[model samples]
Target: MLHLRVISPVSRTEDVLAMLRVQPGATHIVLTRGGALDPEGDAVQADLARECADEVVDALEAMGLAHTGAITLEPLDTVISDAATRARRLAPGDPDDTVVWEELIGRTREESTLNATFLAFLTIACLLAAIGIVTDSPVTIVGAMVVGPEFGPLAALAVAIVRRQGRLARRSLLALVVGFPIAMAVTAVGALAAQAAGWLSLERIDEIHQVEFIYEVGPFSLVVALLAGSAGMLALVSSKSAALVGVFISVTTVPAAGFAVVAATVGQWHVAFLSACQLGVNMVGIVVAGVLVLVLHPHRRRAFRGTQGARPDRVW
Candidate 1:
């Protein structure tokens, strides 16, 4: 369920209330006249079932509330009211399967930001992966996968393509284009430093076998990437965040980057090239699969069409 808060202009308050009153998925509607100071309007609040959120938001956007007033939706962790239950039962689809596109777009936009924290996490994950590769530690490599932040931009890229948002697409692409090389270069420098400190050497590369899969590009690498991408996207739209950890560990993107940089640092050009190939395969597979998932989602398609009448300048 979602809690909707809307500030409607004085003249439109009745219209907003009428709209909410007819929605079977909305309950516990409350109106406070002259409650909004900033917008100087009436405050309207209601609880909405997850399945009806897109519809309600679309209607609100169509009414120009987003520009003239305000509309905000927040997830409801616990709603014990029978009214809420009835609202959910009356909604069109199951909550778990519904896609709140506004929520999704907001989330992916934030994730795609190219910031210091993103770089720090990616570099640390790559460094951990490099350590795992040198010591032949599968456990450490899995840990590195869980730490990698590369999936954010990848997911953002997929969402941008499906939603046809040029600004979002550019932001996602910029993050990817700038992030990976910087992370790999930093990891290479770290590997060089370790080598200088006598903690790592080219000979260790020959002993690595357990983690050779990081650099061994094959058909299954792409297969795993595609599957993980789909699952990751499902988790995102469905709010099943617990499933994301499994998605993170299922792909070898971070490990491949780590292995490639480490191999290059040691002058193992062939190994580096293969690892780079593995990285490319994983990234392409994830983006393609994610785009397919978003485009094929029935609810998302309808929601996209419904919002076409909204102002082009509005950020969903």
Candidate 2:
């Protein structure tokens, strides 16, 4: 659920309240008469949601009756009667018409279980891909695609940008910038070691046929990435973990990164560069598409706002 705190001039409190009352999927509403502030205006607190938030807010602004002095939204666990259920409700279902920022990043900061697991999985996926590329194994390459953790950061970064959360965006970008290169480097080193051991050879690693599937970076890849990114965002907004997994599988970030590592290992600089370009292109495409989806999708914002108690209104 979303918790909104609003501060406006005293004269506009009722106007704001009236707007809040009509929002759909708003589970609760709380009001504060006046609060301490500098010279701005009186403070009013609202605990509504995304469903009716934009409409109500837009209406208030259009009416010119309410002037927003300050606004804040905090996510809530539940409006449950029991404290245990409240505490145990980890994954809150998003409001029908709101946007949910938490799903993109996972709830909580600094070492949430999902984040930690994603990192670990990413490492494993990259390692496997490196092995696959060195050995020219299609099976291993596909496996790496299934394992990579790049999708989470990519999705989160898009949501952050759409929601205007600079911190979230920075964190997600940091994960990607640091994560991708590290995965590539590790994969390259692994491939080199495999070559020295005679488990694989530079010629085998550089074979065009092995990773050629991704070499054809054309409109198909762009369209697929766009669609996959849209699916990823929808999964995030809808709390569909299984569909998110499918999204990760559909995108080619891990496979391309792995192919690049294999090429770099043998000093096939040209192919390696091409593969890297492919990876970069796919990454940028998916992320940009995801940001657009989040910006255009209301559920994500409303989920962030927690409008369970508010009245429902049409978003489209």
Candidate 3:
């Protein structure tokens, strides 16, 4: 279930209340007139079943509440009320299958930010992968995969394409184009520094055999990427953290980037190229699959239609 809060202008309060009262999936409605100081309106609240969230939010958006006042949706972790149960029963689909687009947009927008923290996590993940490659440790490589933050922008890019949000598409792409190169460059420099310190050498690069799969891109690579991409996007929409982690570990994006950097640092041009190819293949597969998954979503058509003429600057 989702807890919805709407600040409705005085003139629209009646309409908002009437709409909520009639929604079978909306319950525990509360109205506080003149409760909003910033927007200067009435505060209306209700608990809506997950399946009806998109409908309710779309209706509110149509009423111009998104522009004139505010509309916020939050998840309800625990709802013991019989009304909430009845609301869920009245909803059309299973809660786990429902897609709250506003929630998705907000999450992806935040995750796709190309900020210091993003770079830090990416760099750290790459460095860990570099160590994994040198030590030929699959465990360490998996650890790096779990730590990498690349999936956020990739998922955001998919969401942008499906939603037709040009600005979001550009932002997500920028994060990818900039973040990967920077992280790879930093990892390369660190590998070179370690080489200079006698901790790593060209001979060690040639001696590693267990991790060769990181650079050998084949048909299975694309297959795994496609599957992982679909699962990742589905997990994101469904709010499944454990499934998301599985998606993260399933892809070779971070490991390939790290391997490419390390290979390049050791003057293994062909190996670096192969690793880069693996990275590219994984990213493209994930993005394409993600876009398809989101496009096929049941709520996608309504979301696409609802956003027509919406301010491009507004993400949700």
Candidate 4:
């Protein structure tokens, strides 16, 4: 179920109430006159089954409530009312299949932001990747993959492409572009320092038992990337966030970036080139797979591509 809070202009309160009254899936309707101070409007609240939220929100958006007022959706973790159960049965769709584009837009937009924490995680992941490559440790490489934050923006980009969200696509791309370069550059310098400190050796670059897959770009790499990327998108849309850890470990995104830096530091020009190619291959595989999966999503009721002017959506 979803709980919605809406602030509507005083003049439009009746129109908003009328819409809510007509939605069979909506329950627990409450209204407070002049409840919003900044907007100085009436606040309306309702609970609806997850399957019904998207349509309700789309209708509200069409009514311009999201423009002159505000609409916020929060998941109802617990709903004890018999009315809630009845609403769910009447929603005419599978709750699990519902996309809830509003939620997705907000979530992907937030995740794609190139914040300090995002940069820090990316940098640390690359550093960890460098360690894994030099020591040929599978454990460290997996650790770095799990620590990498690139998946969020990458997923956002995939969603944006399928949904045709230009701003989101651009932001996600910018985050990955800026974040990876900084991280790879730092990893290169760190590799140099580690060599100077006698903690790493160039001789270990090609004499590794593990971590070879990080730079061994091949057809299998694309297969794993495609599978991992699809699973990651499914995890995101279905609220199965725990699956993300496994998806991270399965893909060679951060490890590939780190390997490129470390390979360059060791003066293995061919290895560095291969690592870079590996990164590109994985990205293409993930993006292509993600777009394909999302295109088939049941909840994508509307095709949003090239709709930059359809509605005013917040990029942030």
Candidate 1 CA-lDDT value: 0.91
Report, for all candidates in order, the number of backbone clashes.
0, 28, 0, 0
Per-residue lDDT, model 3, residue 282, is 97
lDDT of 2 at 164: 57
| Candidate 4 lDDT, 122-175, residue by residue in tens | 999999999888888899999999999988898889888877678899899999
lDDT (tens digit, per residue) of candidate 1 on 98-131: 8898899899889889999999998899999999
Candidate 3, lDDT over the whole model: 0.91
Clashes of 4: 0
Task: Estimate TM-scores for all models.
Answer: 0.97, 0.64, 0.97, 0.95
- Tens digit of lDDT per residue, candidate 3, span 1-316? 8899999999999999999988999999999989999989999999999888988888898898888999999988999999999999988888778888889989999999999999999999999999999998999999999999999999999998888877788889988999999999999899999999987888999899988999999999999999999999999889886899999999999999999999888899999999999999999999999999988887777777767746656543
Report model 3's TM-score to 2 decimal places: 0.97
Q: How are the candidates ranked when ordered by lDDT, highest leading?
A: 3, 1, 4, 2
Say which candidate scores most in lDDT. 3
Looking at model 1, how many pairs of residues clash?
0
Q: Scored by CA lDDT, what does every candidate get?
A: 0.91, 0.63, 0.91, 0.85
Instruction: Kindly report which residue stretches of model 1 are placed more than 4 angstroms away from their true locations once superposed.
Output: 313-316
lDDT by residue (1-316, candidate 2, tens digit) is 5566667677777776766664443434566566737435556555544344454454544544333475555656555544323322422344543454432345412322235566677778988877766666778877888778777677766765665556667777777777777667767777778878887666675464765775557778878888988887676665556887778767778887777777766777787787777788778888888888876874545544533322232110
Clashes of 3: 0
Candidate 4 lDDT score at position 276 = 92
Error of 4 at 103 (Å): 0.7
